[model samples]
Target: MMYNATQKVISLSGGREIVIETGKLAKQADGSVVVKQGDTMLLATVVAAKEAKPDCDFMPLQVDYKEKYAACGRYPGGFLKREARPNDSEILVARLIDRALRLLFPADYHAEVYVTVNLISADKDIQPDALAGLAASAALAVSDIPFGGPISEVRVARIDGQFVINPTFSQMEHVDLDLIVAGTLDNIMMVEGEMKEVSEEVMLEAIKFAHEEIKKQCAAQVELSKELGKDVKRTYCHETNDEELRQLVIRETYDKAYAIARGASSKHERMDAFDALEAEFASRYTEEELVEKLPLIKKYFHDDVLKKAMRNMILDEGIRLDGRKTDEIRPIWCEVGYLPAAHGSAIFTRGETQSLTTVTLGTKLDEKQIDEVLVQGSEQFVLHYNFPPFSTGEAKAARGLSRREIGHGNLAWRALKPMVPVGEENPYAVRVVSDILESNGSSSMATVCAGTLALMDSGLKMKKPVSGIAMGLISDSATGKYAILSDILGDEDHLGDMDFKVAGTRDGITATQMDIKVDGLSYEVLAKALEQAKRGRMHIMDKITETIAEPRADFRPFVPRIVQMVIPSEFIGAVIGPGGKVIQEIQKATGTTITITEADNKGYVDIFSQDKDGLDAAYARIKGIVAIPEVGEIYKGKIKSIVSFGAFVEILPGKDALLHISEIDHRRFETMEQTGLKEGQEIEVKLIGVDPKTNKLKLSRKALIPKPQKA
Candidate 1:
């Protein structure tokens, strides 16, 4: 028998192992790997397109990590019982892998890289996410495609201020932090994870530990690729040589160039100055050299081309693109109640980025239910962000929530969740949508600011108003220079190395997002950016208050009104009878949602109706259902099963009263002959002093009789 296959397996620390065999499967793919641990196995196959998509400005790198129910030895439930769309957790994992490989790909080369991670097993201890990233990188490395040598993914867990490297599912229980960082051997490129609000020191330590463990995994992948790697062709992107023209340009106009970069504020001003500078530099060169030197010099100095300016802008001089001084904020304009039809609406724009947020408040029934791998719970406060192609001066076909969009929307959602008011008193389901009509930079942060205003405009009484700003770091390795720009603009962000966004209230930070395209940054950079972010956030908040200081006194007229009420145990049956007949009638008549939270001797009823107008109407409408004894009121009574000493009378439909035989006819009724009273007889009775303690109404029929005529 002839076998066309080979196999390789490597064991890792912490009872984890990477069992890989490539020759046995998918040989047609550019590169592929099957990684398994126990029953949990993932087959990652990658293929790069021979030709790039037409009319595409950027490379098409599609990384999809999907989970099949059958892999877990189960079938998907429900009609249309199949897996179609990727769950939220799947989208997040796909994004993590995408970040890891993007840095390794060459800049000029635009090719399609599809990494499909199919689950062939299901062992909870060995999560496929970290391995999926490694497998994707390995596929690219072993393929004929050119990439910078090996990137690996690492998962870090922290428990009690201690970092655990490549932690298992069991260790995650005690962990307050879950961070997955992907980086090359030299530095990190992507970081994405969720934390339970841990300290910065602990967080930093965890990242460090993750990087260390990742190196070993990175090593294993390198070894495997060497054994089975295909010959990869190389394509290099063209870069200008700044040294060749630096001296010439400097001698000609260094003094002038410095002035323009320092003094420029608006983008147009910078463009004008850069154009003038380009012309001056081009004048000093010969026609052929001019063609080479002009672009080289412009590339080294212009906003789009020159990235070293980050260091110059930050370290040498604390000059930002918008000309804000250190610890200063850009212009912030906030307007609440912008949309009349929405429950709550606000528009928050800081500098170039803008987010129009609208809040919709609904009953508990309005909360969305999500069934996913990572989370199976109910969420009351939801924040959604939408970034259309036009927002960034681009045009493309419409597609549902992509990885980038989901990640950004989730970041904004986390930043604002802690500020939402909660508990049984205000058990409302709130949703905030921030439509990014324009995005220059920090659109995610803008969503936070606008969402806060919208919630307040809807009279949500949020715990605190939140504002966010995007901080950028521009480093010049040559001069050991660095600059941290507050509220960075689009051009600055695109050219800069790091996009650090911070959001919170005046007191402390609520959420933060950090993404870098450079080597791993020092804690010093993170600390400085965070400190500066506070200043920027507070400044923006000061501006926001000028527009709307606090939440409105009343909720939006269009929003729903929810209230909680308690009723006696005896009335519960009358309110909700056998098969919910009474409750259904109550809902049909008053158009309210009555949910019984706790029912016993005392019951709590949660009522939800649209607006205070509807709420007040329902309140007046349903109060009579649980009607109690009221003094000085008259009610019809029926003799129901009369007794020897007193007659039991039904009053007000459901209430009952006692009639003594002495008052049967203003005199004694001997053997029930003189009174002429029968069962099911109805009569009008006068209400006396109702026992306030018992809530029972007393009535007297003799008092309404002709007693004055006898006197």
Candidate 2:
């Protein structure tokens, strides 16, 4: 069978080209495309159900990104040996695609849409995630699923003060700012990245730089769609609306919703009022009529009437739903040392949102090992975020970890990782867990705040404390009026045009994530939002510092202390013994945990214990094992066995030497039985010499005695 493949090539900076080909693979799907850059290839397919499910009011979009072990010529870890579930890295990539593509689908298009991007080939230098979003958008472009985009996503990295689009994995290592920006040909939609305390202007410059490349990629997708004759999309009726009933609902509910918005009630209180208003309107209709019209009524009342009223109230009156000014931040309160048993704990509350974060310190054994196809390493610092149903006042069972949790945790980790001490400065591995006790908006940002507090509370020597704030935008495109809100509420986040989160210290931004819902968002507006966010972050930072000025002076009494030392690389094997027997014995006898890793021709040993005596004992054992034997040094040796000619003495943990019977005393002895030497005895000995041929230690007890004592 022959297939017609339409290809479009986009030239990026540095003469790199991305080739996107469609109609060559997965032809049975609604749309499919293969995106190739260098040796990396991603097969992206999009499938949309022909009809929407009954009562489906929202766009049901699901995006899955998978990297095959075969792509990178590696096998999956663990006993199963096959992919079980999407890891955090894959989930984050999927989220990037979902956030960029979700808004482009028509609001009324409720059909189930699934976008799957699989990495079938891998390049060591090229990062596949930066290409995943482009593959997904290209697939959608060649499909008959009504999408308002041929958008593309690109990673913009700044190295040595210059912006590079779609930087290689190696180039990213030296980047001060790294961002993934997704956009259509004319408008930017989503932006997320971490930075090294970069200024707002620099961040804006990177975004603009990314958009230029996105425009090129998007144009290529458009050209590809035209070549494939897929510019026209399929038509479907996913919504049924009675024009009169919609008008009646709008007319009757608009004023009521506006009044509720102006009332400045709490989150739950406002929710109940709106629900009551909807019930009152639904009561006017008979039960039979409601069976058919109720869904539309609820949808219209919430989406059109209530959303518009809330947005307009903020835009026109400069009053938010919580009755605060456009730039006003919600109240904040914080506490540290909240959990006595934890290594560190803190509670940070901002308005209705609250986070209880705890920090745990561990040795290298507790470091998280990552074994993904493209990336493999261990992390000394980890952050996990949890959002429960009760946090939002919902009655639902808690499932396993969600993609949102991973994404949010990653952002917080990036925000605080820079402040964490590393290497010799921080010997213990750190894990931070943030659990949302209550939430209204920007819980992830709250996690950043609480994480800083908890880390400080745990006696971690953080470079600087980080605080985060979620900024919102309310704009009138027709009137050219807009407002940049600080510390946005949950309702503002849902109804507003933008949800921009900025986290950092007073120095600059460490991490940022922005999702723009509307089009034509100018750079000036973004700059304004960033500046407003800085102020809000400072306010939150003040609250945080007021509660706890800095990290505690020292770790809690129950926290285990780690003592680190270095030894010669050759001695590491002896210290560990054959099959770890020696190290295990030392740990068991001293009640300590010891970890040894060799780097730079040296073995770094970390001993952990809550008991000072145990720590000191383990340290001494390791020190003696690595200690070089000297010719004149004296040691308290333990006699292992008494032979006919000599006794075997262990001067160090594993260093055994022969103590000749002549060295036992100046007076000669005929036999070992005549000498008072016995096995399992402690005696003082001197390292007399080392055999040139065997490199063995020769010890003597008589050498330590004076001539007069011998006489």
Candidate 3:
């Protein structure tokens, strides 16, 4: 096949260059581009239907990110030996790209657009996720689709008190601030990351630093777009707006909608009021007139009038839909040990949102193994969040996990991960599951709060308790008025300009996610919002502490008992035996679970059992295998094999020594049977000598019996 590939390189601030190439791969797709940074490469393709779906009122855009095992020169680890469903990391990257590009498309365009990004090549040093957005944008830019962007995504990490762009995987280890920022040339669209109680100024500065780099990338995409002669996009009319109908709907419903937004304090009441107003407007039109104009009327009222009224009430009147002050937080209450059967359980409620979270302590065997293209590891601590339809008073049937659930779970995980102990400080694997029982707004934040309580209740010694709050921003650029709302409701999050979430302890911010839908959101406004969020977070933290001030003294009595043991590196093979025969025997005999891994050239074994007898039996066997034989030391052993000379005595679990005829006893014995020591007989013996060269131990029964004064 003939290929004509054109490439452009854009240099970043950190001496890193991003190379974009097109006209080489996936030629049948509507648009395709390969983006490379260092050794990492991503191939992004976009395809859109020629016409919009009938009766579709929303953009049917699907974004998928896949990491191929071949990219990292590894085989897929599952039963199929191929890629299956999207993992959490891949889903998150897809969401990042989706959020950045979704709004850039024409709002009325409801065509089924599918964007797929694949990591064709991976580098251990470079992160592929940060480059996915850029690749997707470059693909769209070179295509005929009508998109308003050329957006770019960059990762900024604060390491050793300095901001770094696209830091290597190793460099991220020391970062106190790790943020991924996606933006266009003019404004930032998304911000998500975790921090170590960093100040608001530092976070803002990092974003600014990231924006400068994003601008350069965006410029590169523009140049590429022009080079490909794709500056003009395809034209389509997906919406036929009736100006008269829109005006009529606004005139009849504006005041009523405004009153609904301002009058109703609860979610259900507010929704009911809006629904009644819409129905009243529909009743005014004749049945024949509504058939053709009903869709238009509903659209105008819901998207135009209702949206405007809600935003204006907050911006102009400083009155939120919930009738609370801008900075006021909702009531909060927390309870721990809600479920005695669970290792740790807590229930956190804030206003209408409630999370029932539980924590479980496990051994290393329970660690979750991750096998991605660029990363292969295991997670010792995992957090999962589930939101059922019933949680929000919906009658829809529960399906499976959605992207929102994974994203929310990930956020809560980051908030609590920093406080979790690692290495030898805490050896048990931890798993936290948060079930959103009731949700109006920010159930994820409630999950964070509930997770902290559960961890403490489970007796996991966390560094500090964490609390999270969702903050909203209402801004009017023309009037220079903006409101920073703390503990925003679901309606506020939908109607406001920004939905910002901050999670932290009393000290500072730990994790944050900011999605800005409007322009001109300056650092000053962000600082104010962050400060207000901190106050809200601290208030929530106070409630959590009131419920459980610290981690419990010990784990629940029903939890399994685990003991760690270290054995000599040489003894590891003997303990494991050939094909795990020895360890299997040990577990079967002791009724315990044992996992051994070699660290620092020593075997680190963890023994887990429910009963004390099982734990003690396993511990004893492991200790015996590592024990060294000493001369003149007495031992209780069992006879393994009876020979003409004597018998072989098994001292330790796997250690055995020779007992010759002369050393059998003080009295002479012609045969081993005369001493009455048979195979499987229990006897006491003394270690008389050990061969230095062969490591052979010599055992004698006469040494244990006192010699009769040299007689």
Candidate 4:
């Protein structure tokens, strides 16, 4: 029996079409779909366990986005010729899909789900990231899994004062706003993008425009699900919840939790109060009774009672857990040049969140090389974020980088990347490392503030000073009432309806990320949130400017000195001799590092050294190699060799001139030895003339010497 292949096409606002086809491949999987736009194609497959593990409490969903080398018709980059770990871009795309779909899963349905989307074909014009989220959602739509999705993802870019949905790669270059928005038919679930300091209204309009196109794709997924007879989903009871225990915990803990939330003034104090209340409730139950019910009680009390209590305190009383009113920001303070040896350092503290960031300036040799299948290049600026367990008052051992760290670092990187000066304007490669010393709120935003200060402290002349703020939203869709929070605490982010972070300068937003937890989040609410965010960002920028108004006048003394120059492309090979002999010799002799590259038919050379002497030495060597000998110019020369007729004198590092016996002195000499210009001796010589046809220089020490009658 042969099954007919079904396909559906959704037209975007810009006339580009995404074709989703099913029943063509991967029949063994629970659900699979191939999504194609232009020449790019992505194959997405989703599989779920029949029953969840007994101990599972949350949705164990994992989404992986892989770009195969063969997809672009190229071999793998490394020596093994195989794809290895996922690159940063791929991990980011996978994260976008996970964030959008994770909230849409059924509350009690905790079966392990794995969604894998692989790029099998590539088109230079179309970006693969925009297609990844849609492919993942389509696979889940045709599956018999319990999901609230049939969602779609689209890339929205503002070009030439017009918004283009699903813009091609080339179109992105001209857009001031490049955002990827994911949502169901009614509301947006996730938004992540960078902009050129656009206004609040402009950003909101882009989102609204993206939602209109997304509605069509969502409708297509719904129809395809119906066609596959997957309108009804599978059932799985993963929770052994006790209704009686849940009510008892709520009844006993609601008032106590409310008091804890309302009375506490600080983060640690509020947390301690909540912890004591939970402990008090547990003490009432015996050890044997707790063996079966303590976990359930704790879960229900914290997740249902405590969560509701905290949210209500904000929604009803219009006060945050820390006793701040809505639209209020926490206290902020900043300091620069915190480290003596670092090229640049800053410490930014907002309420309890603190980031100690340092900036390291390097040469082009230090740029990070990216070897991903789709992208092969180097980045001159990089940002890394580190969050230790001690930052949150925990005692756990340190683990390597987590996805949260990567995500936060990426956000801060975007916020500050555009302000950094490019190649010729500033030739140093910059790396910023943000270490969270204390965190009770948005440490990622703290990173942005600290990074700006650090870059400025390092003497980097950025386009502008940047600051960031994280905004929180708590709302009730039924009542149409909500509170927009500024500089929200960690609790607010976990319990609120939205976690929206906006970063920029005084003009507009540079980067933004919003993850909406509640449904039916209207554009009006989003616009209000953006407006609130702007005020908060402005306040933070004021604090940042108070600490340091602009980049420093000079770098710290310990930083490496980098001098750059451009030479004719023809001399590049000569400067870097066969097997890199020339450059290596220069580095060995001058105690410096040299790197050269050909760009635009010119050789760009960067020389780095630690001391003034070393820098001057390398600089002189490079200047000599590219210099043209000027007649009548004087130079301190070393006699390389003496012959019968003349001696070769080294005038410059790489230049030599002929010094005849007669040119050595005005007096006549019988042989070259009579001139007494022995090898290993230094003398001052003048470039008198050059044979135009031979390109050979003629030097004379007699020109600089005083003659008996005419000097």
Most lDDT-accurate candidate:
2
Tens digits of per-residue lDDT, candidate 2, 68-183, equal 99998999999999988999999999999999999999988999999999999999899998999999999998988999998999999999989998889888889999999999
Model 2 steric clash pairs: none
Model 4 agreement with the true structure over 113-161: per-residue lDDT tens digits: 9999999999977898988989999999888988999888888999999
The C-alpha TM-scores of every prediction are 0.75, 0.98, 0.96, 0.94
**CA shift of 248, model 4, Å:** 2.8
> Which 10 residues in a row give candidate 3 its minimum summed lDDT?
702-711
Q: Is 2 or 4 the stronger prediction by TM-score?
A: 2
Candidate with the larger lDDT of 2 and 4: 2
Candidate 2 runs further than 4 Å off: 708-711
Task: Please give the distance, in angstroms, between residue 707's alpha carbon in candidate 1 and its true position after superposition.
Answer: 18
TM-score of 2: 0.98
Error of 3 at 356 (Å): 1.1
Clashes of each: 4, 0, 0, 0
**Model 1 over residues 445-564: C-alpha lDDT tens digits?**
889889888989999888778877888877767656667778887767777888877776776556666777766577688777777777788788887778888889998888767887
- TM-score head-to-head 2 vs 3, winner: 2
Q: Is candidate 1 or candidate 2 better by lDDT?
A: 2
Q: After superposition, how far is residue 253 of candidate 2 from its true place, in Å?
A: 2.3
